[model samples]
Target: MKIKLNQLDILLEVAAQGSIGKAAKALHLTQPAISKTIQEMEAEIGMPILQRSSRGVTLNEYGQVLLRHARDIDRSLHQARDEIDNLLGKAMRQLRVGFTSAASYGPFTNTLIQFQARYPGVKLIVMEGRPQQIHDALENQRLDIAVITTANHTSQNSMYYESLYALSNTVIAGNQHPVTHTTSLKNLMDYPWLDWDEPGEHSILGQVFRRYNLPLPQNIIHCSSPWIMARMMEQTHAVSMWTSVRLRFPGYSPNLRPLVLREVLPASSIGILCPNIARLSTAGNTFMEMLRINTRDWLQDSDALEMVVRV
Candidate 1:
């Protein structure tokens, strides 16, 4: 059963506007022409697509099925035009990437710089959010790539993820804090602590205390952004649980120091997540390659880990 693209477009417009006359006006077609086209569609499909009333029309179950395919066709046609324009060098390639707050401390910024240098014509958009927000954006196709913690969410069939590296939660304190000189966990808890107010029982802070069979710190300061926490630690005696990679970054040093705890906190996997590789755009794939290569180089660098310890 062959159907015209315009017919599908008309059907979608009608569904959107909830009125045949309104859809006709929107599409610059006459009301009778819109009505006849929909009739022809229903006849060809051998089912009534919409339930009509005096006020307007709404999609029936059959209409909903057709609307789904129509939307897919619209998306594909737009992508086809974009891909063709990119190939002809007439349009800039664009990639939308999403990440959690932890990404600010990771190698993402450095890799993005290399990607920009290599693909100067490509446009990059980066978004920072909580893990749940990033997951929602990925599922909605608003993001082409995501870097998130493994503890965030489990990958489903549509979401593909690969572990880039493991990250250990480190306790950070001001350089002048008394706990900075101590390796004892008991002494570390004597000061006020700051961390995200994450409700999960498996959060790094909760897990660290559970592993030691100790109660959680009562003087915990709940804050979300790691940058704020780092800045606060620089000025105050407040300690926070953060990724050790923060030390490797440029700004966290000279003031912030990771406490040398006797027990190691469990390491969490930091993964590169995207829609199945096949769904990635050219720019997305290129960025992914650069990210993987940079991350590998950073991990293999002996000096990087040493810098973490010195911090």
Candidate 2:
């Protein structure tokens, strides 16, 4: 009438791998040992958990219910182990951060450098993905903080957001692009345009074309990575909408030039999102403080530049 943690883990692994043999290889155990463990677990529960076929094994209804609870238990155990490790000074302080591609420019990089300088011993884990992916990681406790586009979410009670800045995206092309020489938005449409799109979110390219009352670009390239998009622009005549060019950052500037378009797309609000500030670890708080400082500096610098331009 007892089931072990390892047994539950094996079940989850089997489901993931879709076969007992594959799970055995992944868990570094023999196939017979894995079968024995499953048999013992099913015996204790007085029911069959998996339906076996020639190709693989699949979870039955009972197995599905047990697997859900097993995952929750596994997460709880991991949290407990982390807490104990920190209490005993056996583990280094760590902060897990996630950011959307747009948020990874300028101030975000500065904040990371500052945070590392401030806390040399703390470990920093960074992940870049779409807003939904970042939100999922934050909700699952996989990420301590996420910097993302301020999109509406249904899970308002589970997490909160703090605005970092509003980012204005512009159509950018390589310095050598023919479109770069022309001030006409009409001429730009002849070349391939890069688009960043997610399933439910609004398309950046669509907004620009709709604003100008121009038909969508004929040659459209769907890209996710900013670096890749930049490279494509550099090597080809491809163009993409980006915010980093405004900061004059070396990573994004010089290689890419903004085209003069008649339409202005609405700025997206970039923000720091977390489950709770009070629940943040020491390392997380330090990083958050660095981020706030960087944001302030960026705002001040931007204001100074605007004044100089006005003069």
Candidate 3:
């Protein structure tokens, strides 16, 4: 069935607002107009798309499917506009990228500097979050690219993954902390733990504790932001698991040092994630190229090089 662009717009707005009246107000149309547009759309599809209630409206199964495709169409239209703007030498070129806290250590910052130098006219938007958050943003089209760490070298059907390097986690603490001198994992049980991952049986810290048959630390504080995690690590005696490369960065706190434990922690793969369906924008492609160039040397030495899966 054929659907007009305006009809798709009205449906999207109604779904977002959850009421015909609210959508009408937002779209600068009357409530009757919105209802009639939705009716026409339902007629075209031969089914009711929305379930109306006193509280508001909700999308039925067909409506939910339509909403998904409508969002994809909207994103495609935006991307097309951006590409045409770039080709016409417009100054509105923009690239949105997301990376996990661990991926921000060295190469990421360097690549950003180089990317900005090469594409000074392009507007850059960067976000830092956990891997799952970054993945969600990429899926929702909020971000064009993402840098994340995966322990199992997992693959997502809607995205392409390229391994940049392998990261090994280590126990770290303040310089003056008593645990810094400890060589055994068992000795660290008494100290509070600061972690970016959720505290549970599936977490990295939990897995580490299980590996040694040691009980997970009960006193755990979860902080997701890298900057805030660094500050907390500097001020508190709480121990944390951090990547070794981040500790080498000059901007990181000098007060925190890696603990020399007898047991070796597992390593994770850090990689680039891009949407599988859409082609990258000019700026996005340039930035991706710069990232590959910057990480070439590191990738050569990484054991996770074979973990790269471009599907």
User: How well does model 2 score by local distance difference test?
Assistant: 0.74
- The TM-score, computed over Cα atoms with residue i paired to residue i, of candidate 2 is 0.59
Give each model's whole-structure lDDT: 0.75, 0.74, 0.77
Model 1, span 1-311: residue lDDT tens: 78898798789889999999998766656799999989999999999998988988999998999999999998897699567757854344777889876664547788888888887777778898866678789888788788886543345543667767766677888887866454866676778888665645536677678779988877887777777887888888898877756676667777888878788666656778886554466677777888888877877777446433221
Q: Give the TM-score of candidate 1.
A: 0.62
- For model 3, how does the per-residue alpha-carbon lDDT over 34-90 read when each residue is reduced to its tens digit? 989888989999999999889999999999999999999988887886768568554
Candidate order, TM-score descending: 3, 1, 2
TM-score of each: 0.62, 0.59, 0.62
**lDDT winner:** 3
**Any residue pairs clashing in model 2, and if so which?**
none
Clashing pairs in 1: none
Q: Candidate 1: list runs displaced more than 4 Å.
A: 1-92, 104-107, 151-158, 180-187, 305-311
